[model samples]
Target: MSGTGRQLAVTADEVVDAELVDEGAALSPAPADPGATPAVHTDRDRHLSPETVAAIEESVADSTRRAYSADREAFAAWCATEGRVPVPASGETMAEWVGYLTVTPRKRTGKPAGPSTIERAMSAVTSWHEEQGHPKPNMRGARKVLNAYKDRLAEAKAEAARARQATAALPSQIRAMLIGTDRSTLAGMRNAALVLLGFATAARVSELVALDLAAVEETEHGYDVTLYRKKVRKHTTNAILYGTDPATCPVRALRAYLAALEAAGRTEGPLFVRVDRWDRIAPPLTRRNKDTGIVEPIGDPAGRMTAEAAAEVVERLAVAAGLSGDWSGHSLRRGFATAARAAGHDPLEIARAGGWVDGSRVLARYMDDVDRVKNSPLVGIGL
Candidate 1:
């Protein structure tokens, strides 16, 4: 954090929560000029109540905040080297940055930015300027640069769609990932429960993170989940019976996770809370100790997992299990629909199962691919 070009591979998950959640992470100037003022007005607006402050910080998702923070750092670094005004970046400055991203591979992975990543970075730049009470920098030039970069990505066209649509992972693939984890650890237990529950219910990232302790009920057969809210128009409850496999059973996995939380004196609250690298539940949020002049993880726990964090669970697990693809958050929902259609479930039944509007074109799209392959007339003839 101190250097302009220090170690650069650190991911957002590794950074402290304060920078990711609260708008405290500053867009600092060059490391050579440590005396330069910070972009965040640390002393301003001190009269806001504790609850009000918390609400404002919580207004944005933690994942988005972390992304924005990283964007700020990247812009600051570029500006520091180029001697441009970092805060009130001109439209020309923004356009140049987009052009830079178009050619420059990421420092960690050495992969070029896709259209979506470039667009998000643009949003981050504008957002930081707005947060600092500056007028919105015109991004028309930036948009032009982005469009040109996208046109040059004909070879990457398939890869570009990945940000918008994730490849589905069937039940077998999900089961393999669930079974591959070391459930003895707290993180492992929570992750298994999350992935399985998501696959079983076909829950979207938003719905999965919104669940409270009271929302899930354990019954003799399985678990009954009451989804009081849904992303789609339908608002209804859902229930699931026990899994056939003990090693990857959604009900059993959830039970183990609940038991682990109970042992930690957490009886009722957020169903899924933050877990740190130390395998500890709800690690104290991070802050710099006033006296020590060093940053430290401190303060109250950030209880529930953000939707972005919830979505990452599957991808992390997939990579650990050596599986690869455009698999991610939406994969769980898509996978459920795919699996159900393969099982000969009716389109209406599948639609209701995942909270999609009945007779929806979206649902049909999910079903069509399998139907074409499974019901092909050449299948029995053994092509």
Candidate 2:
């Protein structure tokens, strides 16, 4: 629902005044009845119009609301499976949900729900109940279940946290990997550009794989990469990214890959594509010669790459460079944030580059983790 330049003077606690409402009939709609009557009783007159409800919903940021919606949907599905009510959830239902989330592996990461994740889920459920005008679910039992799980996790907090996160591909390790890569090979050139660009842009695997040939524009300073992703509003320009070293430069690596593809008659389409075991982006596009009825190799257009494929590049390159720990595409992003934080760069700059929302907990955690070891006064002193 939208309003036509109507103003509602709202403060932290209550609505102060409503403007441009004198000439209109107050359309108080409800979720149960979208076409609710504007009729008012003497005793009960507090009703929100659809527009007002929408405005209220917008109080929460769109991203957070999206997460809450997903969590609410997941909880509803679980409730259906367990033969229980989701909205007006009882204490026992909430307890079981907490236990289930603790043990159940997530679809994306294949790990048990973290404490933060569980907490978010609970918040989503509470929001749902409140929206339905029901009392909050008694979560005393749920809190006990969560407390027990947290107690076990507290035993090795550092180890558990580290184990769950993708290992940061630090600058030193990146230099090693870049130096170790053989640029002579097509795969080598592609892999080098993939990792370096991933690091430089702090791009997610999905965003990296979604690039097209036209997305990148070469300039004298460096490349201006225009990325369009959901995390990014419209498109983002990662401009003037320069590397000090020749061997580790993303621009040079990308140029080499583009040159190789052009030689094979591929100058357009997907920026990153599947490179087969035989070191081929694709067999040249073949067509039958109608006159002679003979098929021949034509242009070399390539297939698109997947997010998984992008991640494997990071893991494979890290392994080849003899760097230890579990590396994934996220390593690039995490590494960039950590390194920038360590170098005393502004938090907003790091967050903007990584497409992290303002006041992100994960971003704070990454910086805090770096601060911890160096914080002690005994660190520099050989104790």
Candidate 3:
């Protein structure tokens, strides 16, 4: 029978094999029930070859794989709870699920999923069904349901946009953050360098954490940092020029940070790493003193920083600077565009600087404050 005709079963083995088994594991046998009908195993339950499994897994990025896994689990859980078949979810079932996601508050966040999240969840559900050899659910009803929630979604989005606009750090605020950072400590130096480089490059948090020591090349003018575009997986080079002032210059800050790393004999690996509460870089291994039985960490020169870690650097700096507004990793990128526009740079130039391939509209979104101040007809009008 075609996959679309398959029915969802409640057996543990069936559910596990259909959704959780990604490593080509052999499926468990169905429960013994001589009085009942025999269980039918589709090709989906068969153990895939290791090579085939590897190839399939490698087809998507690791982040995408993780998201898809979470999505599948959520869908499966919902199905089990509702006593509905997940494998062959009908259009009506999907429509109801979409509606539930829209109106329902998630247990963890205590907030309804946004429109983009709902759309992605639907995509994940579709992908999971297709992977399990089931026909994709017709989404016509789901689309209508989504449309019904469109106004609420738009309002939620508008609120979020306003929040972001409020958080866009100005040049003075950026300077405050930089000056407030205590550069003597290891964590402070690293954070200062990170903030400067991030602002100068207009880099995403992912891009900031993805930097490697080897990717930075010294040039006649300043330094050329090679960054791999996360979306396109393409290499792009950005230049960090030396600032006239030694204190606020990104190049100087990075040099001081590198010097500190070198002083600690760290010559290779990730450009940024996690610093512990004691203001020390976390080492790869922990060593115990043979005599005193004191455990000492040997810093890991090759350790990499996560995107969350990068965001913390921003937040901590913001707190130190005594700024009252909300701050996040994207604040630096937004700050860059806003600062550039305030500095009299055009939209296209700001877009190119910030790697905004979408166009001026996106860049303008980041520079809302600047646009409001400069482009408003009421700017110079007498009341």
Candidate 4:
């Protein structure tokens, strides 16, 4: 088989042809018999219609499809470089790919990919084969390789317990971050609302960016934010109550942010928007400056913030507050769970508050450090 040096950008018909050739099915027409009548149709002639194929493709989420495509392409590139067939790849070949990913220096960082990254790439390879009607690659060898890699890390005392690991913002840390936010500008107000509301709801960055003004209902106390979709559940809404302190209140901060948007005549679309370098919200297409006599360029009001942007927000805040540790989008959600557990709340309550559907065990991971100290057997004993 010839390597294309990259994934073959073939159409659906080409894919079908390739599969047929791979299966050794006859593509030529049978010899015509002038004397014979046309044979009756049978079940063997039945096949999926175009509509069915389209529906099948659309069933998977767009993000998942994109990830699978990218992963497959990367694997194909690797296979080309190694003189291996990506499609119908052997178990041995898959294992070799795993090893390569583990040790190969990345172009940008010059560091080998991590275990999780390797696993995800492997999964992508498996998914592509399955989609093309090929037998799934026997991953036993790959699994063994990963297990051995992990064992080495454990021997070196580098493997941390998954449950005991989390980068969370403490209350004081959050307060300092809030104080450091310059709320006089549009960007500052948006960032403040983003961080505050993110912490209060324990929402994932994806969820935070997915919020829309239409889904927000003002309540007597604070506000009710409706999430149309989440990783765990399809749809759910959470109530954010007003805080006693105005400066630290997520509800109050959100209200102020909304007021700013309203003043800009933005009453619809995404709750959070992108602010330009000049600290101004991009005006809508229909908006015009009456005094300047110039039409302001329209921006995407319905655009959702990317996860990278959200992580940058957390990192910026952490640095501004002089707090250390690799802070990311997960800090807000993890921080809420950690802080709640430290406040002596029940595990179940914390789980519910954080939208954890897998029970207390999932929530327990965030509070491992707190649990170690609070539930320690030697708490009363002198060191």
The 0-to-1 C-alpha lDDT of every candidate, in the order given, reads 0.76, 0.77, 0.75, 0.74
Error of 4 at 276 (Å): 1.9
The root-mean-square deviation over C-alpha atoms between each candidate and the true structure, in angstroms, is: 12.2, 9.9, 10.5, 9.4
Local accuracy of candidate 3 as per-residue lDDT tens digits, 1-383: 11222211111211334467544334555556779887698776665665566655554555666666676678778989998888789998899889988878888878777666787788878866766567789999999998778776566664422223326665677788888778998888998889889988888888888898999988987899988765444677888999877877888889889999888777888999887788777766678999999987664445678887888888888898789977988889888888888888877776665677654455767667677878899977897
Q: Candidate 3 at residue 199, lDDT?
A: 87
Q: Is candidate 3 or candidate 4 better by lDDT?
A: 3
lDDT tens string, model 1, 161-263? 4445677878778877776789998888999888888888888887887788888888877888876433353555677768788876888999999999999
Best by lDDT: 2
**Residue clash pairs of candidate 3:** 283-299, 283-300
Residue-level error in angstroms, candidate 2, position 128: 7.5
TM-score of each model, paired residue for residue: 0.58, 0.68, 0.72, 0.75
State the lDDT at 305 in candidate 3.
86
Residue 87 shift from truth in candidate 1, angstroms: 24
Q: Can you write out model 2's per-residue Cα lDDT over 1-383, one digit (the tens) per residue? A: 12222212222222225743643445743244557786555523445666776676555445466677788788989999999998689999999999999889898878888887788788778756655557789999999998888888887673433236888888888998777778888888888888888888888887888888898899997788877644434467777367788777778878888888787677788888777788888554679999999997663345777787889889888898889888889999899899888888888988877788778888888988787875766697987
- Candidate 4 on 267-344: residue-level lDDT in tens? 998888877689776544446789997876544545455666776888898898888776887889889888888999
Ranking by TM-score: 4, 3, 2, 1
How far off is residue 150 in model 2, in Å?
0.7
Count of clashing pairs, candidate 2: 0
After superposition, the stretches of candidate 2 with alpha carbons farther than 4 Å from their true spots are 1-83, 100-141, 156-163, 232-234, 283-302, 373-383
